[model samples]
Each structure stands twice: as structure tokens, then as C-alpha cells.
Target: MDPRADSPDDAGTLPHVLVLGGGFGGLWATRALAAAPVRITLVDRTNHHLFQPLLYQVATAGLSAPDVAAPLRHILRKQANATVRLDEVRAIDPHARRVALAQGQLHYDYLVVATGSTHAYFGHDEWAGFAPGLKTLDDALAIRTRVLSAFEAAEREDDPLQRAAWLNFVVIGGGPTGVELAGTLAEIARHTLPREFRRAEVRDARIHLVEAGPRVLAAMPEDLSEKTRQQLQRLGVQVHTGDAVTAIDAEGITLAGRRLASRTVLWAAGVAASPLGSQLGAPTDRAGRVLVAPDLSLPGHPEVLVIGDLASVTQDGKPVPGVAPAAKQMGAHAAAVIRDRLRGVAGEPFRYRDYGNLATIGRMAAVVHFGRLKLSGLLAWWFWLVAHLFFLIGFRNRIIVLTNWAWSYWTYQRHARIIVGRPPPDE
Candidate 1:
């Protein structure tokens, strides 16, 4: 047992601010408190802080794992008052001001819960076995393997129908992740893998994007949604709207009155808050997100703050969207509140600043909704690329990602297609 883990600091004078998860929210909060008079500890199951916005690029083999993630310790190496722990938090005793970890226990003066959310199966958890969701690097690698392996399976298949099934791909949810995935799959068929397979004509592959709502990108303007659908269709992706997935199995999924025979089914439909939120004993919505106060703190527990996807915050009758930007704002607010408390000053309520949204469909196809300034097509694509590159942490990561995107744009080849684990055997 390390002596430092027992209390705030070895000297036991400074207040300790314990941050859960190394995602955008927690990372921002920890950095915001770099000059504060407190001891900071950031704990996460994984060692690296993942840039989740471009996580799909990794799944589609457009970039490698290292390009989108940086080690938490490496990120906070210069922060003398901060400590990074690569361990999962097992339990939190808010009343006791102690947290139970998988390895040990820790005490803290303040706790920020930014554990984030995971894929929701909507009461049909069994569908997860057949259709995987993209959230982590592991999920991305698994999907990449399944997608690449499906092509390999088609090459070995003798029957035309079986080969067609192998070539068929279905993406659930018309949100940004779903749209991006379906579009990239179409590009892979039409441009990336057409010449690689000798027996199978990968160009004949079918990519389907299924959305339960009336249109894809439902959060955007209706005209933009229609444009996104049109762009997806132009990329050879079959866009299905207003049809929810009824059933799913190893072979395919049943939607409405039709069954789609597909070998790879990717899920991007929904997300539920982390189970840790429920453990806090706070009021939560149907999705298990804690109904945090205006200050992003638990109702009865001012010392415990919940932010990011795990927190359900409403501003002026509008619910704050669970995006990276909102999370970052909440994190910064948490830091500010802590600093104010140190100076015997009252903290102001957290007010979210909407920065707009960006979604890229495919090559030279994208849509940006920044308040009244709407842009689409090639201009939006370049804007999206530049915005992501600028937000991506670490100089090396930005350079490597830029180089990879430039290379892929010219050659239509994804270099990080190496499969680490053995893919599922063909049935």
C-alpha cells in the first residue's frame, strides 16, 4: 500500500480533489486545478485519455489507437499536485467521504464523478453479442476485426447468397457515430477494398444505415438531415428511417417487417449513464443519469459533483446534450467551484455554452450546425477536419493524425488494419 493513497497529501494539510475517469470532463477539471491549492488524483480503468470524437476513425482503420489516445500520467506529468491511478473505482461512500477501489480505498475532500456512459441495449442486452457498439479502443478494434474478417469470410464462401450476407453491413442509429460508420463502410467497399479481394468483388458490398427516428441527424435542421441522407445515399449507403430494430441474432437483424441478412451489425443508437451514478443514491432519470443541481453537484451532497454523460443537467428548460464540449464546460465549472470554496466565496451556477455541432458523412461530405451559420459539403468537411485536429490533445497526435488523413485521402488505403485478436470463426 502506498502511503500517499491514504489521505490528501503526505503532509495531510491540503484538500484532495479526486476525479473519476480520464475522459474529456475529468481531464479538463484536473488541468483547471493545476494552480489550485489542492491535491488532485485522477483514476481510470485505462491508462490513456481517449479522444472519443474521432474514435470511429480508429474503428474504420483510418487511424491507429495511439493517434487518438494519450496516457493520463503523461498528460499530467507536469502537474506537481496531481496523481494518476490506473484502477477501477468499485464503490463510493459519499456520506463517509471514502471511495472503494478494486485494489484499495482512498479518502478525499472533494469527488468529481465523470465516469461517462456506455452503450444501451434498450432492455435487449442479448443484441450486444451480435451487434457491437463503438465506445473504447477495444470496441473499435473488435469492430475493425469483424468488418475486415467479414470480407475475408466472403472470399472463402462459395455460395453467392452466403457471400452476399458476408458483404452486407448494417449500422443502427442515424446519429453522428452511426452516420460516420455507415458512410465509411461504403467508402471501404467502393474505394478501399475493391482491388484487394480476388474471389469477392467488395464493390458489391451493401451498407445499411437504420434509424428509428424520422431522419438521420434528427438533432440538426430538417433540411440538413435530408442533405445528410442524400449524401449517405450517394456514398452507396442504404438509409432506412422510422424503422426500429425488432430482433437481432448472429446472422442478422429483423427490422419492422423485414429481415436484413448482414454479417456485421454496428450499434450507435443509445447510451445509458454509468452504473456508478445509481450508487450515489441521487435522483436519476430513466437513463440512470443523476439529476444534478444547477452547480452540477448532487442534490444533498455538495461535496460530490457529477458531470459529463453521467449527469443529467437542464438549463433554461433545455437539457444539456451529452457531448464532449458540454462535459468540458461542466468539468471547468467544478474546478471553479472548488477554487471559490477555498477562498470562502460562493460558486456560481454552471451555465453551458453551446458551441454547435459537426458531423462528417464521407470524403468531401459533412454538415456543420453552428447557430445560424450552416455549412455543408466540401467546406464543412475541411472545417470539421480542422476543428478536430485543433481539439485533439498532444502535438504528436495531431501531426500523426493529419499525416494519416492526408495519406488515406490520396491512396484510399487505411494503414492501421492489423488485427490483434483472432476473429470469430465462420459458422
Candidate 2:
């Protein structure tokens, strides 16, 4: 029996909706439920919802963390029905409709698991210490420190080999993050950092983007992928595809049996779903993503819904890409379903709509593929900028981001490259 069914008169009592993880999905779910006859409790380890698409800009010193993120409370301050809890989820009990947190537990009539994903070092967990992935603010800051500090260390080094090792930067992935990082580094080399160094020649900096796939942006169309590869190469990024990194260490990386010495390596290769998906009592894919139904609910537990990177959704025989737009749509669909059911109406099936695929190479260069439509070069770059600016939360953030982009465009210099905070002792 449905929990709400036991108390029919309690329909207006405001059903409790528990949303886990304040990422794109959970944030959207909480926002969508704010207007409904529901009390929402959003839980996350942090107080802010990060805009992950522009995270590369943060890592590369193009933008600061706040410019791409907003506090959760500030975002939902006006929503009286919604509240946020800065607590980490430890476990989920589907049968009892309870989620175990670090401090206590939360019970709900409707539970949404949008805990998102984390980087997968494959089987080599030790590699993470050397090659950090860009997921959170700390990771970006750490990368910035490593990149900037490398130049500093090289300037003082007397040995040529040691200086070259410090100047060598490797990005282990050819996806959007890797491509963006590599392209930005090229821009820094070609335009920005010449004056930063007095002794070390900045031109010796080598940026290599390594990928196991045959081309960059493999998820996109082949033509677009080729275009991106060309753009990356044109920007002086060494695009290496069809070769896998066999080993990674603080000293360097070994790819396709070839050893390359480097001190800075960024990982953008793989991602796995959060561990909360295992508590759903449902089947999961290889990446530990819960295999959710069309409605994004566990097989026998309709009250329990999963979205974002945690839910493995297949549509039209193709798995839905784990992107922000898809997560937002899933969150909205789940919200609409709950709202309709609360009114004693049947809920419709959830359908995912593919907006398009876009990846930027550098200034005035990007590739976009939407169905049969294909665009690249300056026009696509403009579209990418507009889309990212429009989607960024908060008017202040949008304005700040637009101003930063305009400044970077005319000057070809990234402003937020200063490394702050203490990194790990090894870094």
C-alpha cells in the first residue's frame, strides 16, 4: 500500500520529498518540487551546486569557482517549502523509505537519488594521487597549483631535463574536459604566459592530450570529432588517440609502451556512479549506475526515483548521455510525475530529449552537432558561449561570466590562474 494511500485526507499535508546530492539533478528536483504540495529536503556534502561544464575554466584559471557555482540556500531562499541539509548520505533503505546520513537518518514518501558520479581510476586507484580529475573546486584549484607551480619550479631549475619534465603537461583523456584543458593550455602558451617567466622559455611547455579512442569527442559525430581534433592540433596541442595509458606516476606516464616524462597530469578519462545506487536493491550497470525504468524509478519501488549520473537510462536503443541537460530533464519529469500523482491523476512516461552535443577547442572555435545539423568555427563558439552563459545560475554569475569571457576574448589572458590553498604534500 502506498504511504500516501493510508492517509487519503493527508493529501494536503505536504508529502516529504528527499533529494540526495545537490548536483544538477538533485538541485533541479528540489526546485521543481518547491511549487508542488511537497516538503523538500535536499542533502549534499557541500552547500553549493557547481556548474560542472565550466569547471575547466576554473582549473585553467579562466574563471573562479564562485563564478560557476551558487550557494544552495541562496538559490532556494524564496522557496518556503524547500530546505537544504549539508549532510552526506551514508546509505539508503528502500523498504523502509529511509536514508542514513552521517549524523542521522531521513524518512520520506518520495526519495530521489541524484548523487552523481566520481572519477574512476580504473583498477589503479594509486594513480589518483598523481593525476587528479576535475570534479570539485579542490580538484580545479589543485590543478591550477600544479600547472602554475610547474612554471615556477622550472624557472629555478638548472638542469634542462628537469626543467623539461616540469614543463611537460599531460591530460589523460580526449573528452570535453581533456580537450578544453589542452586547448586552454595552448592558449596560455601562445598568448598569455610569455611574460610570466624570466629564465625558463615558456615555449618549451608541451601539452599532450592522450585518449584510447580513435578520435576526440567520440560521443559526438565522426565529422565533429575530426573537426575538434583538427582544432586541437591547430592550437598546438599534441592530440594522441588510439593509445592507452598503461602506467601513471608522479614522474610521468607510459602510453602505448612509450614512456613520457612529466610532472603534471590531469585525469579526465572515466567516471563511475555513486555508491548509493547499490542500496536501491536493483540491478546496476558496469559503472555501478542503477538500471532505472523509463520513469527513472527502481523496478519494484515506484516511490524511489534515480536521476543524473546515478541512473542508467536507455532511450531509442542508445544510453542517455550523462550531461546536465539530461539530468535537468529527468529531474523535471520525476517532479511532474509526483505532482500529477498527488492530484490523483495518472503520470505519463518519462522521455528524454537530446538537445545537442557541443565542445569548444579555443577562442572562436567550437563544434556542435544537433541531429542532422552540423556547425563549427566562430559561429559554434558564439553559440557555446551563449548557451553556457544562459544556463549558469544567478544573474550575478551570468554577468560575471560574460564579462570574464569578453575580457579573455580581447586579451587572450585568463585572470583566475592564481593558485590558492595548500595542495597535498605530493602536489
Candidate 3:
């Protein structure tokens, strides 16, 4: 059966499945269960499914918001058994088997909690006021405004020190997002913005990547991480390993024992699960992820399944990382289990397949680690680009993204660099 096609029994009297969050996991779950004789309702705070891997590009002006996001309603509108709702989930009453939303309640015969994650500032939540992480579209636009405004403000400042602070950009963490951001920002300063700003030396802007670990891309192989560090340095990004951020303010960041003066700070350090897991009163790991059973179901509540960044699942006694593919696999597995239960058949435990990892440093530099095999440089970058492009939903988005990437590659220009919103409300 074509899951995308509408049928007369699309509104079948099968079991009702409610999936939360329009991210990778929830979207995948909805797709996997499309052919099943079940009514599906997908809920999220936002109305779009974000291609998170390319969110940094949006923030850095490489791609527009629409290029990396697709409307949720448009995606599942053809599936007769499926519906989309834009609402914030306030709480989950597991005993009552109901999800409380800001507007009303949703009763689920089978629940899938794929609420995803948010940036964690350790215990120093105040730092978030200065160093905003890239998670949502608003965060991307806010960072873009701060970045572009720095150049505008620099042009007006006569004091050299103040201008330097405006030109300096600091990114916390050495993960994929941080590394990609630092590299792209460096390119923008060195290649793109220099022509736009005549008065100030945009090329002289400093980009620093601060990481607590001894090396960048610590999750990857050792050699790949070392190579990435070198590639980033070649792009003129100051790589600071073994350095932890102590404080962050509007002026700058305090790392190790020294103070770095900068007006722009991007936080990509760590992430914690969404508050929905805690609301369920389920056992969570250190990262605040719900600990689920082998079948991706809450303990003693087989009817409810939790996957993606919100749930902590183990395979071969090792915990799964909160990545896109992992989430997709878990979501598919959860849907299978629900289908089996509806068919009066016992379901097997969910198993996650290791699908390697990839992180790109700059335009043609990347690192990929697939089990024991590792590759670096341009080849890895190509792989990364193709993988991301292949995963994005809809042909129109794929064409748009490809066009944007090709344009950026040929001209070294970012088209989505426009600054929106009112100008700081006039001091």
C-alpha cells in the first residue's frame, strides 16, 4: 500500500497513536505507521520539521529557514489516518494515559514520546542569557542578528578595543555544530563580509572555538579528530582544547584563567532531554533521558513508547547516542511494536543499528567514522553533504538546498544574510 496515498478507510477505527514532537523521531514514527490501520496524531510546539543537521548553515546565512524546514501538516496531509496538531505538551499523566497540552488533553491508546532535547548549560543557566545555543529557528535568527549586528556596530565604534570586541566571535564546545559554526563564521569574515564592510577590516575578525575536551570531535576516531583540528586551524579558527568556559556575559567569555572579549557567543556544548520525560515521572539518566525497556516502552507501560533524544535506550549494554539516524530507527521500531500489538502478536525488543558518524569542518573538509573504518577531508565532506541532502524531505527542499550549496560553493557568498526585526527599539 502507498502510505502517501489517501484511502476511504484512512479514518479507520484502529487504535489511536499519538506521537509528540515533529522532529526526526516523531516524523519517522508517523511515516512507519502510515500503512497501519491506526489513527495517528502528531503534536509539536512548532509546525515544521527541522532538518537540524543544516541549522548551522541557516544561522551562518548559508541557507534560508525554508530550505531546512518543511511544514508538518503538508508532510502528512495525504495519510488519511494521520493528523497534525501544533501545541505544547504541558505534562504526561502516565497513570491516566493522557497527555496534557496547553489547549486541551489527548488520550492515546499508544503513545510515542519523541520530544527531542535542548541545550544544557550545566548548572549555570545564566550563561544561556549570553551564549544562546542553536536548536530552533528563533535561535538561528537570533544568532544571525547578533553576528551581522556586530559588523554594523563595529563600523560605528571608533575605539579600537570596542571594535575588536565587536569583531571577535566565540563558540563554546567542539561538537559538530560548534566546529561547523566556527568554520562557516570564519569563511564569512574572510570571504563574504569583507566586500560588504569598507570601513572596518572584516577579514581581521577573530573566531575562537573553545572545547573542554582535549580534542575536537571527540566522539569520532582519534586520528579523524586530530585531522579536523588541523583543518579548522587552517581555516583561521583558533582552536582551544582542554579549556572550559567559566563565565559568559554580554561582553565576552571567561575560559580557563583568561578572559576573551567578544560580543557574540554560540553555545553548542551539551544537551539535555526535554522536560516531558521528567513530567512522566520515569527513571532518567544523567542527561535527563527517560530510561525505556528493550522494546522502547516505559517500564510496565508497554502501551507507551519513548524514543529519540528524550529516551535512553541501550543496545549490547551500551547506551545509544542521540543522533538523527538513531532516533529514526527507534521510531520505526516503536511503530512496528504497536502494529504487532494491534495484530495480537508478541513484539520483539527494539535494536539499534550503528550507522557510523560524520562531521564537516568547512566547505571541503570533513571526518567520517564507520565502525573501524575512518575517512577524512574532501571525501568525507562529500559524504556528509550527500547524506544530509538525501535525508531532507520533499524534492523542492532538496533542489533548493542543492542550489544554495552550489551557489555558496561557486561564489563564496551567503544569500540569507538579511537582518530582520526592528533596530533594538532605539536604545
Candidate 4:
């Protein structure tokens, strides 16, 4: 489809598209452009693409890391024009249409920047050490280790206050990830650990879910949010809304003008766009997200595109929510634009379709909002279970996750609750 090409046979020498990140955005864009004439080079810091929504299960020791991730090369192996590179992008050169990597540089006729977002500590980066966020496999494993180690440490301590500190688990942020982590932690303490603990009464462990917002799952309908909040409380999660954390350290967190003593804290709070957005040399929002054009391209640089959580795009005067569906839709739109350019046709402006929201509390409890339909309790949980399993990347992952869920559902036991690093060797 290149204008300079004498015929279709010469299209292989046409444009080169460079896609950054292997999340939902970049992966969908790469697959969408499969039949296009351009050659695609997908670069990401990690070799495997992670299913972030399921990462909570790993953090809570319900699933292993491998159950939620798949190799990028394995995904694109069938695409003849697609190549995967496990490299980190350092900077972007718009004039040259190239990206600077740690080891080398890459040039592209069309660049898709979908590097996604990272957990933000709200200008309190130091709090990161105490309240680790679950965004990667390492983060999940680290949290698992901390949670399990806390119980083990408590077993050795005889002082009541020290044991209480070990059993106090505080989760900042009431979004889906926070709620899930808090709920699963409650399940583990109230069910799994109680059966295993010999000396300490682990069932007395306190789990708190604190949110600065007015309600949990603010993105969802108010009724559903309230429903989810109720379910969490029923499962023994202390829900604190309209509360902000002022500080976090080895001891615990200070929130709502009070100090809570705890050794393990999980952060599922606010997120800022990945630092890669600034490399585009474009205007970015306060959270460091690039403002994209109507067609999902960088202003004054149509060849350079930004999507996913890194780009700020609005529909009906509302910014597109940073979710897997929205990211995939934006990626497809960007691919369509490139396909249009190849046919010498101008692409239409991007439009986002609004889908409903879903949030689960614990086993057999969830909330869902789909247009006029609203559901909660066990029915919604079933829907949530099916949707996530269907969206999982690999057949093996789906099977493993389903097996794990069934095992937990029947026995109230977590098979993958083993800790990594710093733990005693099996031998």
C-alpha cells in the first residue's frame, strides 16, 4: 500500500511500525496489523505479557506467577510480519521517528507508545518500601512472602501486642485490586491460615481496606459500590471510606488522623502514566499522560501514536477509563488508522464504546453493572469468574486458574501459598 511501491509485491519494503509494551494495548495493535503491509517490532521490558487483573490472586497466594503470564514471542509466533523484542525503551526521538533503548535504538515509520501506567504513591515514594504495590510478578511474590512470613514471625512471638502487629493487614485503596487483595487476605486468615497455625490464633488477624475516595469502586454505579462494600465487611474486611493515608513505615500506616500498627501493607492506590509518555516530547497531564489527538495520534506528529493508560483520550466529555477493554479498543483504533493511511484514506476520529463494570468481593459475592442490567451476589460472582477465565491469554493458564479456583472453592485451601526468596529451602 506504499505510494512509492510499483506494485503490491513491493509492500514488504514499506513502513516499519514500532510498538512499545506488551500489555493489552500493544498486543492487540500488533495482532490487528497482522495483514497490513508494515513490519512490526514490539518492544517491552519483560519477556512475558502479564494478565494484570489476575495478579491479585498471585499476590494473595491463590495462583502462581506463571498462571497469569505468557511469553510475548509465543503469542506473536504465528504473525509473519511481527517480531518481539525484550528490551526497555529509554527515550523517544520524534523527528527521527526512533526510540532509545538501554542497549540500542530502533527506528520506525509509525510508532505506537502503549507503555501503560504504574502505581503512584501520591508523592510519597518512600512509603513504597512499607506498602508494596502488586503490579508485577516480583511484587506479587514479595507480598506473598511478606504475608506468610508475618504469620511465621507471629508464631514465634509471645507478646500479645507484637502478635497483633503481625496479624494487622492494611490495604490502601478500595479499587478492584485493593478490594480483591483485602478480601483474599481475609479469606486466608479466616480460613486457610487458621487450619495451619499451631500456636497463634491466625483467624483473629485483622484486614483493613482504606480508601480516600467517597466509596469503593467509584467507577461503578453507586448501588453496586455499596453492595461490594457490604460484601467485604461481611467477609471481615474493615472498610474505611473517605480516609487518607498520611504516612507508612515498618510499624504501620497513619490514616484518618490515627495510627494503625501493622507489619504488612498492600498498596492498590492511584496510578500515574508510565514515564515513557514524557519521552514523546508532547504535553502531558499532571499524572504524566500524553494528550492524544482525535485519531489517537500525537498532535503535530501523526506518525507517532500513544494509547492505553499513557494517553489521555476522552469520549462524551469523560476520559476513557484505564482498563483492559479500553486499552484494547484504542490499540485497534490506532491500527485502523494505519490501515487507512496505507489505502490513501484518512481515518475517522476515535470513539470509545462504554461497557459495564464488574467487581468481586470474595467467594460467591460480586457486583456487575451492564447498561440497564444490574447484578450482585453469587450470580455476579459466577459471571465475573466466567468472563475472566474466557479473557485469559493461554489455554494452560485458563485451566490452571480454573483448577485453583475449584480447589479453593471446595476445600478452602490455597495450594500456591508458598513463599519465595529469603525463605527456607525445601531441603
RMSD of each candidate relative to the true structure: 1.4, 3.6, 4.2, 4.3
List the global CA lDDT of all models: 0.93, 0.88, 0.89, 0.89
Q: Provide backbone clash counts, one per model.
A: 0, 0, 0, 0
Poorest lDDT segment (10 consecutive residues) of candidate 2: 2-11
Which ranges in model 4 have alpha carbons more than 4 Å from their true place? 1-12, 423-427
CA lDDT of 427 in candidate 2? 39
What residue pairs clash in candidate 1, if any at all?
none
Off by over 4 Å in 3: 1-12, 422-427
Clashing pairs in 3: none
TM-score of 1: 0.98
Query: What's the true lDDT of residue 39 in model 2?
Result: 84
lDDT string for model 1 (332-397, tens) is 999998898789886789999999988999999999999998999999999999999999999999
Clashing pairs for predicted structure model 4, backbone only: none
Clashes of 2: 0
The superposed Cα distance between candidate 4 and the true structure at residue 324, in angstroms, equals 0.5
User: Candidate 1 vs candidate 3: which has greater TM-score?
Assistant: 1
Which ranges of candidate 2 are over 4 A from the true structure? 1-12, 423-427
